[model samples]
Target chain A: MEQILANGLYLGAQYALIALGLTLIFSLMNVLNFAHGQMYVFGGFVTYTVVAQLGLPFIVGLIASAVVLAVMGALIEKFLFRPVIRKSKRDESTMLLAAGIAFFLDAVILLLFGEKQRGVPKVVNGVFNWDMRLIMPYDRILIAALAVALIVGFILFMQYSRTGRAMRALAQDRVAAQLMGVDVDRYSMIGFALGAMLAGLVGGLLVTITGINLGMGGPTSVKAFLMIMIGGAGVISGAIAGGFILGMMESVGLTLLAAYGDVTYLVIFVTLMIFLAIRPQGLMGKPWG
Target chain B: MTDQTQTTPIVKGSAMSMNRVLGVGAFLLGVFVLVPVIINLTGRWDFYYTLTSVALLSVAAAGVWLTFYIGRINIGQGAYALTGGYVSAVLMTQYGVSFWLTLPLAGIFCALVSVLIGLPILRLRGVYFAMVTLVLTEVARLTALALPITNGAKGITSIPLPGELSILGLTIIPDFATLENPKLAFYLMAALLMVLTYLVLWRIVNSRLGHLCRSLQQNEELSASIGVNTAMLRVLSYAISSFFGGLAGAIFVAISQSIYPSSFVVQDSVNFMLYCFLGGLGYVFGPMLGTLLLYFGWDLLSVAKEYQLLIYSGALIALMLVLPNGILSLLDKKGGNK
Candidate 1:
């Protein structure tokens, strides 16, 4: 149980950061942003290029990934997302459109990076001894701290900052927010950029622990999807809670089910299905109707 | 969605007839027939599996079409195909069921298994549904790998091809009187695809069921208010899709004569989606076109396996960006809008 708890928290940190981005986009855009996973992959690639290829400092790579993805998010908003929003294409169509972009982006990355699994060098390597019997990676400890800090910081911004309030306003009622002079497009761009940056941050943290690879995005995207479903979309707390729940479920699943390493994914999806059937609004989601 | 705009009636009675359908079907049948003959005639038996691969891959593509027509994407088709292939291979090799008997049984098993997966998964909406399907396929893969029955990672092989059948001690194997050889398995596959396509789609698309499904696609709220049980219809769509997906897998096993879990990976599912997307979604004929072109292109690209993924991804990106709808959408530009 201790091992499961330890593993779950470490895994959960990654989930929370990625899910935060997914939920933010869902709340404001009404789309799942399927390419968010690809964005995560892009984050890994950026970090790898800076730290590994360019021989830059680890901090420089981490910061550069967030900044670069922020720009990519803006571009996505301006080009890919703008048309979907403007047309008010059915929400389903928008999701498909985003998926198409993700598919294309993943392909491009595969072409550019190849499919080999490459691990980013661990920035900090130490084991924190809790009990005399158990130890955990210091990298994991850092990830957990960063995730919590980011979540708190995001909540504070949403509650207090003028731009954050504008984002909230746009999410709640786009037309009314527009009437109140909250530039909807600008707010959406802000939401998207923030989402990308957070996803990039997770990607950076992930590579430091696991590795960088093009195929990572596909499963990671599904995990984010499951997290949003469980926690309910558009709510920051929901994203965090959902992410941890998913991570815990996966970790427990791995320990209990010896033969299936990918059991985490299957269990998460099945859980999502049950949750959606019982409460489509999610654990914390408000009913759109 | 763009194709939804191209509903202008063209040659309504003449072009859409069962007779025309048969004619087009026969022409397609003839092409499959001619290919192998040309191969045999040219004395290139080494290339036979290539043609077989195309025909078999079409079955998976057709499976994609079933859900796609209803405006849902089932990324798990490869899982279903793998399920059928594995089941058929196992039943044949271990239990010694004749290859022919095992084939249909595989299809039946896949349909039943899909129901189990679909029951929980069908609840997800749109992108969520796609996500869940993706997850389920991966689950299917991992489960297959973990199972002792599958021999774990090693996989099962040497599935014996059933010998010629006899009814009451009389040979059921008719002599190859002319062009219809026993290798006419390709023709059998083509025929099954056409029949399944017609029965599952042409019939549904022309019926009240089609109206309900399309209505759900167009406006879920309005459809529900108007007495459509949207959830039930969606489940029905998935079930039907699974049926064909299983059938495709069965046919694939029959043609290939062996099965492995790796044959139906997540990447293959994505490729199947690429086939459907490239051909055009929501059209009965779309997957057919997409399968033929994409696989044909894949075969051509095999020489450069290292660069194939790059080119494949690049092409997919280019296609989706240039034609969000699909290649068939270009049919409109050709003034065949009718």
Candidate 2:
């Protein structure tokens, strides 16, 4: 039971970190940004390049990736998404559009990078043993810690900061916020960039746990989608809840179906379908409005 | 300007063009029929099977085009194909059912599965629906892989050749068996089936149901408010599409004589959809063009697998960037102007 709890926390933190970016983008632009997973892949690859090839400090690689991807996100919104967005009838079309773009990018990346599992040197390697009966990696512990800190920081930023307030206002009502003197476009641009930046952060952290490759985007993006659906769209708190739920479920599933490694994905999808049917508005239904 | 505004002239011109189109279509059909004969004359009759493969893929792609007609991009259509293949293979391998009965049964079974899955998914909108279907396909695939009944990813093999049947005293036997040549059988069955499929689709497009599908794509709420029974129509379209997919799968298994999980992956779904989109989603001939173009490209670019992906991806991005409506749209516009 303790092992399950620990496993869930470690997995949950990773999921929550990834889902935060998805929720932010979904709320602000009402777009699912299917390519958000590609951004995570970008994060992993760039970090690998810096740490593995360039021999830079892992921390420096993380920071640099965040800056670079944030800019990329802003540019994607300005160019690809801006004009065609109105052509999209619903959030679904926007997601499809983004996914098409991601498919192109992923293929290009795979061509350049090749389909090989690559990883960065672990940050604070080694495992922590509790009474010799429980052993957990220190890196996962660091991930959980960092995830908690980021969640706290995200909450404070949304609650207290002026820019964050503008972001919230834009997410709640784009036209109303514009009428109220908020620069809706600027908020969206910033939100997209910041969301990407967070994804890059998670990407760097993820490489420490699991290897990175071009194929990671599809599975990662699906998990993030499931998280957003379960937690509710447009609510940061809901993202946290949704991520943890998915994370714990996945961890438990992996444990139970250890013989069938891929079975976890099926469990996650089945659980998500059931949960969404029951609470279409999501876990934090009131706050989603 | 006066001539342009005249409906009689435009209508007459369009009617004339329609006649030309039918003539051209018939010419193309004739060429398609003669492909095997021409290959046989060249002493490379084995190429006939490859052509049959293309025909089967085209039929499956055409089936998927039905769902696309309703403005829903279902990534789970491959699930139906996989299911159909597995059902036919299992029945043939385990229960020793005749291939003739198993063939049509596969289509019916797949249609039923499509309705079952489409029920929950139909309620989902946009990307959520697409993503959910993708996930569902994966789950279905994984379940198939795990089940011992499927040989657990080793895949079902040695599926019997479709048996002869006597319906209304026709005593139909597969052509290849009588000719003692596989290529002859392939060309006769696949080419004929494809021609029939195309005709069926053409009829559908000209029918009222096709107009309703287009209306559903344009605006769902407005169609519903107009008493279109939009949901039922969408479900019906989905079921019909799955039937085609299943039929294609059954034929696919019959030709290949094996069914495996690897043959039906998420990438297969993505590839078919890509073919549809690249061919031009709105055009009836889009899938055929897409299948021919994409398969030819796939053959040409087989050397550099990684670069092929990059180029394919680059081309897709460029296509969307340059021709949002797809390659067919350019021809369509040119045809319209002419």
- Per TM-score, the best of the predicted structures is 2
Clashes of 1: 0
**Docking model 2 quality class:** acceptable
Query: Which digits, one per residue and each the tens of the lDDT, describe model 2 over residues B20-108?
Result: 57976785666475675688679876567667777777777887777888888777767778888888898889999887788789989
Q: Once superposed on the true structure, which residue ranges of model 2 sit more than 4 Å away at CA?
A: A86-97, A132-134, A158-170, A173-188, A233-235, A257-262, A284-289, B1-24, B27-31, B37-53, B163-184, B303-305, B331-338
Computed on C-alpha atoms, the DockQ of candidate 2 is 0.36
For every model in order, what is the number of clashing pairs?
0, 2
TM-score of chain B of 1: 0.84
Q: What is the TM-score of each candidate against the true structure?
A: 0.85, 0.87
Model 2 accuracy (lDDT, Cα): 0.76
